[model samples]
Target: MNATTVSRLTSFAPAAISVLAIEGPRTLEFISKCWQPNQGSSVLPTNRIRFGFTKATDNQPRFGCNESIVVCRTNHERVELHCHGGKQASEKILETLSSLGAMVIPWNQEPCLLARDPIEQEAMEDLVHANSIRSTAILLDQMRGALSRELKRIEQLNANGKLQEAVDCILQLRQRFAIGKHLIHPWSVVLAGPPNVGKSSLLNRMLGYDRAIVHEQAGTTRDSLMERTSFDGWPIDLTDGAGVRLASEASDPIEIAGIDLTLQKAREADCVLLMVDPFSGWTNSHDRIYQETQGKRILVRSKADLQKATSVPPSLLFDAQVETSVMTGEGILELQSAIVAALVPEAPDSGIAIPFRTRHIELLNRLIGL
Candidate 1:
């Protein structure tokens, strides 16, 4: 082949060979010999068609076998074949292509096939095993050019020599992306408080099922019970820990282990929901837990329906409170909305690109610092 033809051959060889393409005046005739209609009347030279074929037996071609093959032609210049989607069939087709002197390439290296942009690629990877609809949507949106647009904008600004403005925009977007990471991935939210504060009930309510057993008995949930759920389009890993309490002789070693685990989880959580029984008011233990939680705390007053009025009073105990009743479902929606608002603050603006990975975040942080 001449150099020009060789380049063309190289460009189209991989995909064409994989699909068993044939190129010659007699290509259609060759295909017709091996092709037998399985679902349609005839295989057209200009359209894609499926059929079946078998080895010749006693001077007769097998009409139909266990599998069907699809054939198509493009503008009379190339013919394509799609065999059964099985290992053996694919191998046989590949062998046939090889015999025809067609070049073969791995599927990933085929450039003629549609390719996803970087953001789209990342989004596809993110959504492959997404745990929530919200996460899926976020990935889909990102894949659909959200990140590309932002990066393009930055590039355009940089090309224009608007260094300060470009840097500012990137910095802001980087911050938003940091928060968006938690939304796209599962975030730990530890439910902790004194014993019998309905932490387990709240956990079950959030999960929309009895994932964690609840009882009137204190310390019924002697260990941490983890349930996965989504809140406000963010994947939340909810953990109902054994209520924080002073260790006693009656406490099982397992229960003590659970408390230790709870404290560990508390330290690692992105947010902490400190449950308090409104009827009993906050105690010293609650204060201790709250102090330990520092500012990563959202005060959730459980059993709100049992109160005289379904409202949080302006007391030190009620400060920054979210009232909730697992039984009556009051304030659940509000609490969820509040949690989302407090956590994410706002949805990322359209065309704003944020890194979705910790590595990206660290790199961006270093970039900013420099």
Candidate 2:
């Protein structure tokens, strides 16, 4: 309990600032060795942020000692260091602290010391991985005890002999868990179709840039290229998979492997954008691919600009169809909307309690069973 502990509270990636927490009996002794305040005393003022630059100690080298930093003594045994977010600055500082007998721990391990409960700790951990603003908002609510308050309400109802009411509340939370589960794990949307179709073009258009290789040649994309993007505030991993064709037509082994990989990604994706054009109209191969995916699908009629007064096929049954021309940027927004609607048909209201973790869902299921 008396040993000093040092942990980085921010992500390891480069940012505007990185936070490091030093706690335990030796916190002040370690802070004094590295940080030199601009004014007043080297002694850190309790709860006040002091501007300083880390200086080299007798035992440590001066490699990253000159970086500007700010320190705040949070409590009797806790001090927060705000330093440059670049890897070198933080790493050197942590190295200095570790060399001075401070225990260096992972950022994730620091949450348990600060969070009041497991739910809040999980929320804090998930916040670092949140890809979209919407997901961050939900995790922020959870961190602020939104889920904890709901659980308490359920407990209160059950204690008062309102068993049915408590069960109903747990059921609602369980239903909301569907959205919570996707907060950290972005939805996977795979673009799949035959060669010469505009699958890659549509993926590039949706990404607002050229990420996948778009070519006139068939099978230009020999492998799956995945790019992460946000549509309507929901994080989506859009995969431009290799063109799926019959084994007899695909002569190369690489293409066959890519085709197999495409089917695998399709099977795992939250939704598959089945692209087809007038030249390569929906065929038996496309049907087989769709059947293999066994998931939500949206038919994309690509290269509409080339379809000059072409007749539409009536036999194709699909959950939804969007006619798009990447050249004209047509139907792109509609496609994005369709994808979001397909993945998240009903979004939970703001401040609603959501079970973001697997344990939360399990607990809710157990409560409902009771």
Candidate 3:
């Protein structure tokens, strides 16, 4: 008989639990050879779970966990093995099973057995690897045919020759694609400014902990520090770049490398938090740094607690700017809201149809043409 193919169906990172699926014509045979039931005979019911230990090729306990795992033969061709969710633990279990002749692959490399339709399939596929809860919810919404229902109505409108209404609907839906695409990937938000301007302070305040170092010294940070955190339930990668300094002000070679990374992060960032020490107000240096961010920037005035109105220039203005005082914890919430607004200002109404994958977007674009 052919070997059963095994694939991990859960995240590889350490978690509370991990699941692996084995499917093939010989899945039952493979399980019969390796699975040792705790209290009953080796015969497994089609739909019931049997608490057991998997044996190595030499017939020794493979998992040998403090608590044994439960195995289920879901059907004639499929079996599922669930175990503790550590990288090494799960990998060891998989390795043990593989030694007895099971082909191993990632979850996406294997087709989902229970997906009911195309929408469900896509949602299931995306949901499995989704890095954030928001992405999971969005995928679940799509699985309920959220996008399908909207497309159906659009198709009907096209059939009725109501071209104007259809065009308007398509335009509205098209606007949501960018937001949807970022649901899984996360938008990169870079904190950039001159040294001691409180870029790191803002980052720390927003994250509710001191992830970045805050000091009075210039060029204190010479490396980019990044963290992935959720804002208003949406995922975002917060990048704290090294402070931007004038060519003569660059402290050393390390600072130069850090400055290079700062510029690179600002250029690549989906949203740039361009900070200025309001105590000193807006200056020519701030303006020069602002120019480097181009269109993808949000101006922020830091140290509002030590505000000096005269230090601020009258002509200082930005399309997106907020006053923040990390010491007093003011405007931090507003800053978060502004970041979300800058990244994905408009989320679809709850339960509304929205494309969750590139394939769905492509099809919607085709319909827009029609």
lDDT (CA) per prediction: 0.64, 0.86, 0.78
The numbered model that scores best in TM-score is: 2
Model 3 — which ten-residue stretch has the worst lDDT?
59-68
Give each model a TM-score.
0.70, 0.92, 0.83
Candidates 1 and 3 compared: the better one by TM-score is 3
Supply candidate 3's per-residue lDDT for 91: 83
lDDT of 2 by residue, 1-370 (tens): 6578899988777699999998888989988888888878887769998999888887786743488989999988899999998988888899999999999998777634565777877898899889898899999899888998999999899889999999988988888887899898989999998988888888888999888888899989988889988999988899987899988888899999999999999999889988878887777668778789867889888888886433435675666888899999889999999998888889778887889999998887777664
The local distance difference test score of model 3 is 0.78
Candidate 2 lDDT score at position 236? 88
Query: What are the runs in model 1 whose C-alpha is more than 4 Å off?
Result: 1-115, 248-251, 278-280, 308-320, 362-369
lDDT of candidate 3 over 136-172, digit per residue (tens): 7887888888888888899999999997898888787
The true-versus-predicted C-alpha distance at residue 22 of model 2, in Å, is 0.8
User: If the candidates were sorted by their lDDT against the true structure, best first, what order would they fall in?
Assistant: 2, 3, 1
**Residue-pair clashes per candidate:** 0, 0, 0
Q: What is the lDDT of residue 181 in candidate 3?
A: 80
Model 2 residue runs over 4 Å out of place are 56-58, 61-67, 111-114, 308-317
